[model samples]
Target: MSWTGRFLSFARDERVILVSIGLATFGLVSTMITALTMIRDDNEIPPAEPKTQYITQDTEDSLQLDTLEKLLDHPNFSIKEIAVKILCDRAANDPEVITYIWFGITRPDYEERMDSLRTLAVLTSQTGNEGLARLHDEKAYSALVRCMELCMQSTELPVVTDIHWDEYYLRDMGERFCLMFLTELINKYGATMLVKAKFVEKWLAKQAWGNTPEERRRNFKDYMDYRNNRITDIVNRIKHSRRGLRALEKAGLIDKESSRRRIRELPDLLMEVEEEIAAGEQSGEQQSRRTREHSAEEQRLRRQHREAMVLNDGTRPLGREDIIERDASPA
Candidate 1:
């Protein structure tokens, strides 16, 4: 017989069953080999470390006092906060920590600068001789003045978002903290410090609050309030002093003519603030009236639509729940 004839005979014979079993056996062995190869490859690969473990290891192994000080300028606010807190705690025992905190005020990172200010506040708030000494530190005073000057010169507003809202809020808090700290310093050490920094007149001037009208309007009330409070504090100090203007003049703390000018102009400045506040109130009322009118108009239109729907359907008006149910029903 020919080979084709023999193959045809094989397809018709029981031996075909043996051939099928052999093919099945070959496939199973090939599959096992592939799976074993994959298993070996997986075993050779290294496992990845958890992110938290990596961070913990890095901090514990590599972070030193100087490293933490440098971390104050880190982009992450949480990192910066941690660094500042660590540095502040160290400042109590090591005065060298204060030097790092002072330099942090001059950093380009606003969060770092603000955190440094907060640390200084805590350091200065310590009771007894230590606190007194920190408050009197000329270097601390100079750093504080430099921080205020830098803040005043910074006209750019950071973009506000949910992620950045804390930074924005801290910036405002920092400004207020700076002012309050300055007030405390003046009260304790006198205005000579400000005079020496040549910031006395700048503080007296109307500060640039914002770049736009909307921003200015938003900040107007708070800025004016704080400014008024600061000026009032200074005026009160000058007035309550034992020898008054003459004593201030003799001590060369503040210019004699300048003090007289500020006193004379105080009433006019206060009257201007009151008038502006009244105008803002009136504007707000107008806006509220417009909003109420708009709401009423929307309610009226909704009622008309409901009435039309009832007339067209020849039935009771469809309520919100009824409409929702009708729409949700399977077609």
Candidate 2:
């Protein structure tokens, strides 16, 4: 008989068994298909995590971590934001990534540098302790300080005159990123902005451009003398310097009214900041002195008490800490 005919000719129990076998096979196949569907959905959807593992280079995924790393300054703000969020969550402690972000901020490309710094500011704000750990990194601090110097904080300093350079490069940078940096660190991170300001001042005036103390002093003096004639300097350079002042004004380091946009008015504002810093330093010194004096007095009283106790007991008196340790030891 043909196979179909044989199945029809089977006994009742055999027919039942055949039908049962067909149902079981169908169920197994359906289960496997469902499981595969779920897995594909998981891969296609956004992950619950803020940062995902970098897809391997060989993977067909277009959004590889390494690729995103290179695109931190991408013109599309969303892409850069995504890249930074991923790096901060997944690679928050990576030294290499930190250097990449910091260097990216200081890059010569004005627009790119500004974009990088904005990302970095967001990053440092979100990473908490990881950001704090980097706060003390001297190299990172110096790079940031250099970036801040690009701000024309002192109008009498110098004008950027490189023909190939963007005339307002530093000004634009200061407005968008550098000034924001100091304010962010101080307000959010509680950084000592005054110390950084002093550092930048010293580097520019003495450390950056001279040999001996006399030579350095002369260099700074000459620099001031050159910019003495503010009106003669290009308008764009002065405008850029104004942006620096605006940044300072935003930082709460300077309080200036909008009515005063004149370049000559900046010196008085800078003097206010200087006096504020000096007064803070003086106050800090006085507090430290008081603390030292109090500590010394406590030490003297303890020593005198010990001497009196020794005489009374006819034995050398031990310090309270020493006595506690002696008592705790096995006899």
Candidate 3:
């Protein structure tokens, strides 16, 4: 199957979202600002002694492409740094390399994704290759944006028959992958991600709660109705099981059946029914508040990033020196 086919299967699932649109878009923005943007002002980044020696020769393509990609997640920082440098020089422009990088990151492994981000962060600070970095940035961001667009265009909303609606999956993606991994670099170094924070704000505001709370509530109501129907079907099946069993006995001497299936599934179905009942229906006011809270959170994140400049660095983030100092600072 193609990447598109595999991607859709994940997207349609209620418990999983593969390289989700929101998260991927957020990741692209994160890389664009922090990883791709070069700091030019010397004042923002004071000179520091280079801890690692520069490579005299262009050993960029020296390592086999497959081997170099593996080094991105190597246990040692020095090895990972070298791999980042090598890839930034040559492999950064290669489509296969970019795809390989994305494929690695899209997995469910947290440590693996962070290691990838760490490599990108290193590439952002490495000097003497502005044009190459830009090339990489453009290609990577464009492909990610395209992927996000494809997800949005997908008509694969769960049928809710074989599957049930669950907001938890999106929450998982936001917290685990998008919020945690993407923000790891900025938070660790105390660097301000002003653009990234803003991007997050805008993206969140585009959610159901922000733009059309009433419409969203109506949609949820429809979903609730569907849930109710499913619950009813299960309840009827459980209550009428004995009658069906009798009818089967009359039809034939009745083959054996697992009485446990009905018993075991009953508790979960009942729980879902009770939860749905308690949830009742969403109100316009509640939806509006959610939207406001998201907007407020965006403000808070922006301010936090803005103030982080002073705390993370002596000055606002601008040049490569700031990163070097942050690296040199004792953990």
- Measured by TM-score, the strongest candidate is 1
Q: Point out where model 3 deviates above 4 Å.
A: 1-54, 59-80, 99-142, 145-206, 210-331
lDDT of 3 by residue, 1-331 (tens): 9999998987798655644767888988988777445544433667798796665565554667798879988999999987877767664556665567565444455555445544544444563445223423333433332332233233233332222564424432212333332233322222122121232223222234212444443443344345543222222232223333233223222322423343222222232322342233322121211112246555453333333222234332122222221122222
Better of 1 and 3 by TM-score: 1
Clashes of each: 0, 0, 0
lDDT of 2 by residue, 221-246 (tens): 44434543221121112122334444
Ranking by lDDT: 1, 2, 3
Off by over 4 Å in 1: 1-90, 126-129, 155-171, 206-228, 235-331
Could you tell me the TM-score of candidate 1? 0.36
lDDT of 1 at 49: 78
For residues 292-330, what per-residue lDDT tens digits would candidate 1 score against the true structure?
Answer: 224655545334333322112423212222221112222
What are the TM-scores, per candidate, against the unseen true structure? 0.36, 0.32, 0.25
